[model samples]
Target: MAHVDSIRKDMVILEKSEFANLRTENEKMKIELDQVKQQLVNETYRIRADSKLAINLERSRVRVTDMFTDQEKQLMETTTEFTRKDTQTKSIISETSNKIDTEIAYLKTLMESNVLETVCNLAASVFTCLQ
Candidate 1:
């Protein structure tokens, strides 16, 4: 009977020790789980912030693209207007040049006829003196 009581006391001690170990392990696991939860929260916040920044950058890019498109359109219109004006100026210059050429041709013909008449008159005067 005494031996049986001693065995029962040893079993109780072993069971208490096992319970203490389990409690310690449970506490460590709880601490680890808390750390994991904190990390998840931090990661979520970082992801949300990154998404917001990406959205803002995309909006800015679109706005800048629109502005560039508008500027390009305006530049094209201005270039077209200048090209039309240049063509008109060239036409005016061409007309003026043609008129000047016509006047120059007429003057050249008149000068040639006058020179021929003067030469004939001089010849006639020389012949008269010789006779």
Candidate 2:
């Protein structure tokens, strides 16, 4: 009977030690779970930031493209206007040159006619005086 009592006391002590070990293992497992949760949160934030950066970059590219297109349009308009003005100036110069040539020809004809009349009048006067 005494041996049976001693055996029961030993069994109780063994059970208490097992319970303590289980509690310690549970605490370690909880700490590991918390670390995993924090890592997951950090990773989620990083992904969100990367997505926002990509969106901003796309917007910037679109804006730059629009500005370049506008500039190109303005350049083309300026070139067309300059070309039109140059053509008009060339036409005016050609017309002015033609008018000057015509005026010079008319002046030469008038001078020749005057010289011939003067020679005929001088010859008639000389013939009358001799008679």
The top-ranked prediction according to TM-score is 2
User: For residues 37-117, what per-residue lDDT tens digits would candidate 1 score against the true structure?
Assistant: 566556556655665565566667776777566655655665565566556656755665566567557655755665576
Q: What is the C-alpha RMSD of each candidate to the true structure, in Å?
A: 55.1, 58.2
What is the RMSD, in Å, between candidate 1 and the native fold over all Cα? Answer: 55.1
What are the clash counts of all predictions, listed in order? 0, 0
lDDT of each: 0.60, 0.57
- Any residue pairs clashing in model 2, and if so which? none
Worst 10 residues of 1 by lDDT: 1-10
